[model samples]
Target: DARRTPPAETEALLTEEGLGAEFVPARLGGRLTRADLLARALRPVFRRDVALGFGHGIISLFAAGAVWAQGDARQRQEMAGLLLGGGRATILHHELAHANAILRHEFTARQSPDGYRVGGRKDVIINARRAGLQVVYARTEPARGPRSHSVLLLDPARQDTAHLRHLPRVETSGMRGALFSGLEFTDCPVPADALVGSPGDGVGLALRAFQVNRSLICGVVTAAAGTVLHSAVRAATEDRAGPVARRWHKPLAGVFADLLACDAMATVVLRALSLLPASAHVLAAAVKYVVPDLLRENLEELATVLGARGHDHASPEYGALDKLVRDLPVAGLGHAGSASCQAVLVPQLRGLAERSWFVEQEPPPQLFAPRAELPDLDYSLLGIAGGGDFMAASLVASADRTAALRGPGAHLGALAGAFATELRTLREQCRRIPPGAAALNDPAVVRLSDRYARVAGAAAVLGTWEGQDGTDPFLTDPAWAVLALTRTGQRLNIPVPQLPDGVQDTVLGELLRRHREGRSCDLDALAYTP
Candidate 1:
């Protein structure tokens, strides 16, 4: 359906409503000053249509984020003008097979008297055919390392088309309607000013850009899962025979808690992009790796609630479920998939374990506050490794405080303590092992990375609960907190004894209540009308 209409058409409608400004920096005459706010503004679009969201806007954001983070004055102003005009822009970095591994990139921009001539090809690029500006990562020299590559802003409108050609659209299973194409450049010349940042800064800029891209993508995909939860809950609530509702109540409640826990992870990570940019790389990777895996599993479970209706295209409202299930995974693939994200973590575990994982510093309250004001995103501060994780450290401290208290919160506190203990054990093991790139590919390291992600999720949810100021009933309640921690523990294969009686009933009742009231099951403060 997305392919049936031109992406530019839908993009223009969103642009008319100022969606383009959502990706532009506030200083650049745009609305996007904070990552959390950007997610909030785009939530409705992603919820309604993933393809349109990607084709019309998000892919451009990926291209623009790099410039916003590393671009010179001229580059930023140029990008602002292009996006404000509703013109699509995209980043061409790694081939699909490479998954943003810059070392493997074959595209090159050789120096010339006139300027630089770009050569090679880029495929699986969204909006490539229509994008007015393509921010390309090309090898500028024969040398290796971070300095060898340079980022260039290619303006198709200004280029000589004598050798530049747009590759035919490539059809795919999901996001079928977006313009997924390639660009082949044969000595396409451009002015030297097209280079973004300085030569040799491209790799650093890209690594920093990944932190932003991975964080935003995690938030968008999580919102899509929120849409799925809404639809499933609607089906359960409107079940005519009452049997479906009864059968799905407990499962729905468990999944709802999982979504909340996952939402908390994404929420904290996005906020961290601003509050803790120096240490946000690992946190962002944890979010990218963990959140989508949870969503994929949750969607599969949701299929039971939708029954046969999930596959029935005739039921337009609910049938979008099939498309969403197909499309959500696509967002996880482009820049980095789960394996690549985990690969980033495996090597950093040693340093994090030694210095930061269980430290006692209190995270900024803004990280827990949804849509809270944040400091400017400084891309230069973002690193390959954050050296420490304040979220995990804070989680351990908060759980200790709760576990020390006498009362109903103690049980949940103990679960938190158990999670913290597991993390400590993981750190001990990771510290003793060789922290190398080769270790990242090891199965043992992969499993440990997975456990590390679950630990991060538990930490984020507990951190959110501890920071709540009692205004939100569901979030403030220990019941959901207990369920959230318990579910995360279950994911780690930790022992979770049978829940106390009425736990399921109470949680399920709240889930159905939220659904009936048209409220988001995630940490989002807004309610869903449909």
Candidate 2:
């Protein structure tokens, strides 16, 4: 009877429409062009129930995507048979401390002529016990650097599950359906082809999987919020209790607004996603960062509406509301979990901030330019022994002031127009510091370290492009990342002395204050202050 409680497996399978045309067709059934749809479906399921969604929902999406997006036809059919046949339920993640299902290993494979064995453990796997199919993400080489990972779908029957039997079962307050556990590979043997992709391509493909996971996490949150809104409406209309009627107005309004906003955002992202083959690291990062707030907001309002009813086990609202509270946090955290997602996002965004090229002019360029000339660029190399040293030092230069970029220059365009904003950011950041502390290498010093790296790279590159190159070069020059980093550094209270007070930097300064001290968001409420 307990097993009959319906994990939504049957229903979701019935709903598996494939990624349709959205996914890149690999061995996996179909592929998703954009990551947003994944989030859209996930939000509802998660809000409905976190544990089941993540535990089972995660595997389903991957199974589907693996077939559609990651799997070659052979892989897809193999997985399709098991999944469509009703036999797979194991998610092996967290064991490696990353959600990177495809990154490779620094350690090389160990083998005898007879066969080879994988000898590490997958730290935290979901639904790990007795799964017929195991989705194992492993490194071909130990310390294979970050990018050398891969995702492999395996038969537990082949590798050793002896370790699985001994893995400790974990207890969680929310999303308990996941049945979390760890794994150990003790002389585990597999055929030579266990590799997911060429070793180096592991991280890239894994990233694809993670993007799907993170985006869908938004759906989980939305669902949680929607459920709250649904319940509040029910209470306001049906419950006769004076308190329920009186207090429901504002909370209900908040939930309703949140739901609408969620839908709008979802639509925008989904449409945008369809146009791309897969979500980029930056786009995925943006979604992961913003959507969590939505989920948290939704759940908090749901809690408020339920109020006294929230605590009573006997109350109809108790189970779902309590579960919602537990589930919402998990979505924010993500599959490999929150902290892991953050580490990945922070760097990816930082890269986007640096590499992007833009100009804020009186009249923005035509609403749509041929997607060709993006951003800006400029660079020129000198006529040296081998080639010309780059001449432009103002807009571009080498890190140590060596190696001038040469011409027929690929990196030059109208992008230098941002010189005005870039200079302002540097000046402001410099102004914030007490004068003498502005070192170029110090991450804390705005313009000195990574902060300056963006602007400096911008200036250096743009300066090099003295004469003729197409307008296209400027569009893609990567000065945006520099400006963005400096600005954020300042806001975080981390000084980017090289660049300061830029609007985005200001936000970073604010964030730093929140991070170092108490977060300014109502300490009394979100903190659950007694």
Candidate 3:
């Protein structure tokens, strides 16, 4: 884009390509890439403008797919022309009130055999007013479980116009100008064909979408973070001539460490991405789990160097940094919050869960990983088990999704049972940890271990089916809620109730026991060298 098109030409390119109806796939007139390239290209765009970059870049995914997924080829072609000829934008069916999943809130078409009116509102919908197309994910409780909800693509011109009001400024601390809108679909009419896929398949389809969204998020976050690191290092260096040089090396070291950490994370994300469909849910969740907090740490650290002026919009040099940091949260929180990403990740811990399906049991580690090595793993685990019960719940989620438990009621039941067992196992393990062996002294280890125990404890305190139907909630994403609790306890490392001494026998303990003592160790022991 930088080579052929002038910087100012971006908007014009959108017009030329008839991108207003972008969410439409090539089958519907838009030129979209396969998943891998799409994920990579998004990185640069995120640096420029997270919201718009995400909005325009993904319109094809959201808007186009919503319609093309549901409509017959002819219907898609007809809509395609309208877009190519220029003047159609599609409404992406996302309920900000929900986890951008398939649970819809408005139901105008249920009673009507072929025609329906959509009522209720969709908040934080991108391109709600501007698009000619609206792919709405209305909540239709279809017998519960995975496929309970469905996507319905609407041409707003045909829906109720009275309630179509643009949302207020509503600026967030992060993700500015993302063009978020609230749509009150009051009695909005919808022809039967507007539905994406089979009548009751919306939520399932959205699950696939979520997977894609998660992977794409990693790419974007990776690129933007790289920019931050580059800038920070430059700022730390360029003053070589100054007498303050004696202290300069320390700052350079921090910058270097941050850079190395970022590089390692980038490699981790790629390895995860390469794992693909089989690994998508967990690996993408892991990257989404760690990257944002990384940026937050770097940004906070960089700010100290730039001083109080880093926060000042008045300083041209620092303003960009401020904006990037402010925008950091969106990427950080979006692909599932860091916590949710972690929760999803807990069950996928390389060996712990692998034992359930594999022929061999993974060997328990004798020596622990170095401090830097622990962050991502622990963050992923800690976020998952906020109170200690997360692992149990994760076990449940795993069991519920298993082949034996695919039926809605059956899955929920299995999930519940597994969750119960998970809590028990963790509690027993927590009890085994010796006293004063660990602490939240390190963010990474605490997040993964001790905090996980706490989350397990909390889950015991709160049953899985306590308040809402396990299958009915979109906000059911187990991130933030779990993260807060897990992060707290992760650092604490106290054992949960039962089995042992109510202490957490952590990786940190093994690491310290060997490394600090200068004892010989295995392959993992060698990786911790500073």
Candidate 4:
């Protein structure tokens, strides 16, 4: 069962729903438009099954994103037509070990008079055997720099089968419902027009494409974590006198707050793709780096709350948690791992430390407003590095506003002030990291990047709470924000004061209310039918 694809009926249902159109842009004869909305639309599928979510069409989306981002008019139109017709597409990179950091491409594409001869093997590709379209990363030049690689769009159905071989499917511990396989190209020739972007723009195109994919992925995976938390809460309520149940109150509230925090960051980052493209890459990397770790920790805690039932795969009630626990790690390491994300932030921290942190203007409130209308996603605007630390600036701005509040909400001001101070401390540490040592190989730089990511996450929570338009009572309430920041502070090793009276009870009450009402634990609080 762990080595199989999603059930045939599930695949049929997804196809019937025209889910493949979600990958193609609206202008290109499909329904895809906003990045945040795309993630929201995919949540129901992910909430029920992460494997189904990916195995169905997200792999095609991932492969087609490059085409959408950099493909020529003909290429984009052709790719869009394929996706619109419910055909599958998959991406193939040289190796998974160096995700997004294309150090070298083992898959070679030698130049020919009429076309390029692609030859090499790409392993661990998702949906390799079934996809009709393939987007491959290849070394087009013999040199060893950023401009030596290229991406090629290929149609395997038209290729000569003699030179193209599909390797054996890979068996993995998680997301087994998704196919993972390899492709070996023996002098397979693709037309010269198959090139995406340009001859040496592979690295840039890949990075830009990843910025969108990474942000949306961070938002999508939260549904899985939300499901796990809901299950744990249900189990705890049924057996309140169990050993772990007695102490589940705080942890349950904490996980709920963490989920909200992750959603806040993810929403803002996804919106930034269209609203603030210059800084979106860094924000995306930060969310990608921090959210998974938080969700993984939340899952571990929920597992403990469920006790032995968490591992009981035969129990209809708790069996889903066991599968989710296995799938969350694979999701985290999918497009880019934690270290790769941190590596993105490390080199950019010094620039922000010197000129941006306190100096940059806070991002537009629209960046934090989940329902705000956004401009169309412009792939041309996404930069490799951020302009400044606008999210961090928002933290400082929120602290200033919180200081003006009086009465019970005054404690939140103090919490906000503490995070503002933490940002200042982080800026100094980042300033000290030598420019030459900002690479991932430097442990000190990596640690600094981690700290920066946490601070940025705290900033996102503050911005979201402030951006609420009094429409959602829970989101407008500062109690969850207080708990969210306190949890973040604890992670950063800051000595924080105890929560004010009734704060835990308030958050716990809302958590239970949502469960009893069959609502999701995320910020959306959408009703779910069981």
Among these predictions, the greatest TM-score belongs to 4
lDDT of each: 0.77, 0.42, 0.43, 0.82
lDDT per residue as tens, model 3, 1-530: 21221244665665675554433444444544244434444444555556555555555444554444455665677667666665545444533211332133444335376665566665555555666666666666635555556677666666655745555533355555554556675565577776666766665555445545554554455455444434444454455554224344333334333333333333333332222233334434444555455456656766656666566665444455676766655433544355455544444332333233223221112101111111111111111121121224333443343325432334233333434454445444444433342322334433554334333333321222222234423213222122222332333443322212211222213323443343212111122211
Q: Which stretches of candidate 2 lie over 4 Å from their true place?
A: 1-47, 63-70, 95-115, 160-168, 240-248, 331-338, 348-530
Quote each prediction's TM-score: 0.94, 0.58, 0.58, 0.95
- Model 2 TM-score? 0.58
Where does candidate 1 clash, by residue pair?
Answer: 3-177, 147-200
Position 287, candidate 2: lDDT: 47
Global local distance difference test of model 4: 0.82
Worst lDDT 10-window in candidate 1: 95-104
Residue-level lDDT tens digits of model 2 in 322-398: 66666555444434444444444333322233333222111112111222132210000101011111111233322
Candidate achieving the largest lDDT: 4
Clashes of 4: 0
Model 1 misplaced stretches (Cα beyond 4 Å): 2-10, 95-105, 239-244, 333-336
1-530 per-residue lDDT for model 1 (tens digits): 64345565666678799788888888889887677778878888887777888888778888886688788899999999988877789878863211333334468989999779899886567777888898998888787765888899988889888988888877766766666777889988879899888877777777788888877877777777777777787787673755345678666887888878877787788788788888888888888888778877888888988888887756756876788776765655443577778767888877778877776486777778654678976666677755577878777787788888666677777888888789889989888767556787688877888898888888888888877877778777777778877877877888765566666677787777777687777775478666
Cα lDDT of model 4 by residue, 1-530, tens digit:
35366678878888888898998888997888888888888888888777777777677877887788789999898888887887888888753321332223368899999999999886667778888888988889889888988999999888989889998987766777887777889998889999998899888877887788778777888887888788888888874553334478888999999998998889888888889987788988899889888887888788877788887867767767788877765554443578678768888988899999899998888988867888988776788875787898899999999989887678788888988988898889878777764266888788888888998998899899988999988788899999998999899898676788888778888988898898887788999864
Better of 3 and 4 by lDDT: 4
Summed over model 3, clashes come to: 49
